[model samples]
Each structure stands twice: as C-alpha cells, then as structure tokens.
Target: MQMSQIVTNFFDACVFFPRIIFFSGLLSLSGCSNAVEFVQIFTGNNGPTGPNLYHFENKEQLDLSWVKSAMSRSDYEKVLSRIDFKRQVLIAVSVGERDSVSENVQISRISLVPVADDTIVDVSVRVGMVSKECEKNLTSYVFVLGTFEKPKKTLSYGGFDMDNFNAGCIAELSGQPNGP
Candidate 1:
C-alpha cells in the first residue's frame, strides 16, 4: 500500500477507536491533562449562542505537556516527563474576516480548575492578545474559548492531536512545505 494509504489506515484506526475519558459534566474530565486528541478548542462570542466565534483547523498543534503545565498540578508532571510550553501553541481555527477577531492574539496556555459549586472543571485560558480592534476602534466583544458537549453543556480537552512533532524536522529535511 502507498504511504498515504497506510497513514490513512492508521489514523482511521486510532481516530475512530473507542477510547473514552471519564467525565461528569463540563467541570470534570479525568485526562484533560494527559495526551487526549482534540481537533479544536471551543470558544464563542455571546455565549453558546453568539456572533463572534473560533473554528477548528488541522494545522494547529496542541502541546498538552506545555498546556498542562499551567494547570495547578505539579505532581502530574512528575508521573510523566513534561516540556516547557512557554509560547508554543499550534491550534488552527477557521476565523474568516474575523482575522482581527483573534489575530496576533493567541490564548496559548490553559488550565482546568474545579468549580466549588459542582464537580466540574472550569477552563482558564492565558491569552496573548495584540488586536487593532482592541486598540483603536475599541470594539467590545466577549471571546469564549474551550471545548464542550452541547447536550450536557460539558467542556473538555479531549479530541486533540498530542502526538510527537518536529520529527517534524523531517518535513524540512525532505524540502516539503513545513513552515508555521
């Protein structure tokens, strides 16, 4: 079989496989810190029913090891060797004309916290923003971030690609288009 065919089969097996994380609503997910494959982070404007929003893309990568460090759990890192995720957030979003919506502004780091009222994880994002809209026009819009299940209204860090990259460098070595 061709290399693409093999890759397709492998992804088909892993992507469609039934691997589940134990979650109890939006606040509680067992492996939000571990290597769960997430295709997108759900953030919206005007709550779940709003105008401004971000979409998911395949190019953007997730450094959970880096993303997880922002979490309040140091011991978790001890179990698995961790990497420093200073500003390396590779998440792709479908922001059409709203390029200015979250442009130059990247919510690179995130953490999961326990909500006192319920057994759920509250999502916190550490954003690095430099938007012209936020400067001159002073346009005001609420930017929502993170993933969730609508029926249960539960947010999660699952459904992402946490595989090793930079091997990645192979793309460069092969003279392939590998910038970004």
Candidate 2:
C-alpha cells in the first residue's frame, strides 16, 4: 500500500476508538439519573391551598393545625440523637391510604448525603388516598441548617388521625469555630 494510504487508515482507526468509548460511558451514567429526585414541601391548614403553604424557618410557626399533631417528642428526640449532624441526613416521607398501598410511593425514597463543605438533606412527603384524593397524596420536604426541635402540642383538634400523615425533616448543624 502507498505511504499516504497507510497514514490515512491509521488516523481513522484512532478517531473511531475514542468516539465509541465516550458514547458508551454516557449511556451508562444516564440510566442512574433517577438516583435522587426532588419533591415539594408544604405546611398549613389546607396543605398547599395557596401561597400560604410555603417553606417556614420555624416548625412551631407552621400552621400544623391542619395536621392532627406531630409525632411524639420522645420519638423525635431519639431519632435526632442517632443522626450525625456532621453528615447530611436523608429524610423520606411516604403517604398512603389508611389501608391501601398505592400512596406516596415516590417521596418514600427521600434521602440525605453530605457533600464537601455542605450538608445535604433529602425529604419526601406523600399524601395518601382520601376523600380529597388530589390533596391527600400531595408531598413536600425541606432541608435546613441545625438540628430540629422536638414537636410540641399547642392545641387540640379532636378526632384527627395525626399519625395518618407522614413528614420528615433533615438538617446539619454548622460546625463550631475552634477555640479562641
């Protein structure tokens, strides 16, 4: 074969090899895109009826009146103690019918992971099937800095099944500065 023809063939082979490898690598990573997903968080009497159901800095300030009552303080404290604020916390909330499984299946997988220089919190809330089907399965979540306070009861709304709904919050407290 002529020298020019041999050189041309060599260049073509080199270009084709890298292009094949690059495309296969991209395909593998694309399948893992759903590894983590985002879910909206809401709080108030009506559960995102309007702008009122936005994020809140203070949990107590939340109009949880719509919610029967939060989980017991002792239980919350126990969970908090087990968590490491130095690392990001993953919180998952899943809602389902009182007796059915076709509920907040998506939000149930919420999780938290600590990234360099920052703590990441993951939350998922699922509203289950109820008379208000659309509103029932709605889910939301929030991530904040610092540990959460135990929920305290401030009033009573008789007959509501507070436990029926599931909610989770995760946050990492900022590190303290070194000694002076």
Candidate 3:
C-alpha cells in the first residue's frame, strides 16, 4: 500500500476502537441503577390487604399501627413504643379472618437481621382463625426504612383454605440510613 493510505488507515482504526469500548461501557452501567432485591412475607387470615410496601429514609418515622392492632391495647403500646426507629427495622403487617364477624387483627414480629447497603429483607407471617366450617383470608404488608433517594415498592398475594389459612406478600428497599 502507498505510504499516505497506510497512515490514514492507522488513525481511523485508533479512533474507532475507543468509541466501541466507550459505548459498551455505557450500556453496562445503565442496568445498574434499576437493579433491586426483594423479601417475601406470608400470613394466615386477616393479613394485610392493602399496600404492602412502605419506604422511609429515617427509622424514627417507622409506623407500627397496622401491626399493633392485632394485639391487646396494652401489649401493642408496649411492643411498639420500645422499637427504636433510629435503627433499621423491617415491619411486616398480617391479618387473619374468622368465619364469624370480628374486627381486623394485626400481628407483629421483629428480627435482629443486620441492615447493609442494598440489603433486601424477607419477612414471613402466619395468621390463624377458629371455626369448624370456617373460611379465613390473610394478608401481609412490609415496610422498609432506609436512606434512598426514592422509596421502592413490591407486593405478592395468595390464599389457602380455612383448614390451614395461608397468604403472603413481599417488598424491598435500597440505600443506607440518613439519620434520626
């Protein structure tokens, strides 16, 4: 090949190589922002029947009302009041229904799972009812408090016979704690 032609080809190759690499790198990074993990929760009758995902940047703002109603008034106040929202808390709400008419009930449970960056929690709830020819429905809700730019939401639903009422829900959260 002529000298001028060879020189032109070398410069063109160098320019095109970097562009290819740069575009590929950009494409890979685009997928990272939308990635998230989820946790699962199960319940018996009277489980959470509405929104299951609650997101909060500060732990102090955590709300346990939905779960507190399931227990006695005194017990509810005691258990909920002791919770330190300053620390990370995974809140799950479940409801159980009986064949006979009654008010909705809420059940609450806590775990000592460590909260880490990009952490997703899986909570399971089991609700029970009493009746010989009974039909029960259970629902569950999960709230994750963290310091993310925006909150995240996820949900699942299922039902079983009153003989062994079973239902469930799931949710996820991302980021770190901002402060109290």
lDDT of each: 0.28, 0.27, 0.30
Locate the minimum summed-lDDT window of 10 residues in model 1. 169-178
- Tell how far residue 171 is off in model 1, in angstroms: 30
Q: Judging by TM-score against the true structure, name the best candidate.
A: 3
lDDT of 3 by residue, 71-124 (tens): 345754554454444442434432221233222222322111112223332233
Q: TM-score for all predictions?
A: 0.24, 0.25, 0.31
Better of 1 and 2 by lDDT: 1
Top candidate, metric lDDT: 3
Model 3 TM-score, all chains together: 0.31
Higher-ranked by lDDT: 2 or 3? 3
Off by over 4 Å in 3: 1-48, 51-60, 63-76, 88-90, 96-117, 133-180
The root-mean-square deviation over C-alpha atoms between each candidate and the true structure, in angstroms, is 19.2, 18.9, 17.6
Estimate, for each residue in 1-180, the C-alpha lDDT of model 2 and write its tens digit: 999999877654432211111231232211110113333232112111111111222334332432212323564454344444333221322121122222232334322222222222333333332333323332332111122221222111100011224322221111111110
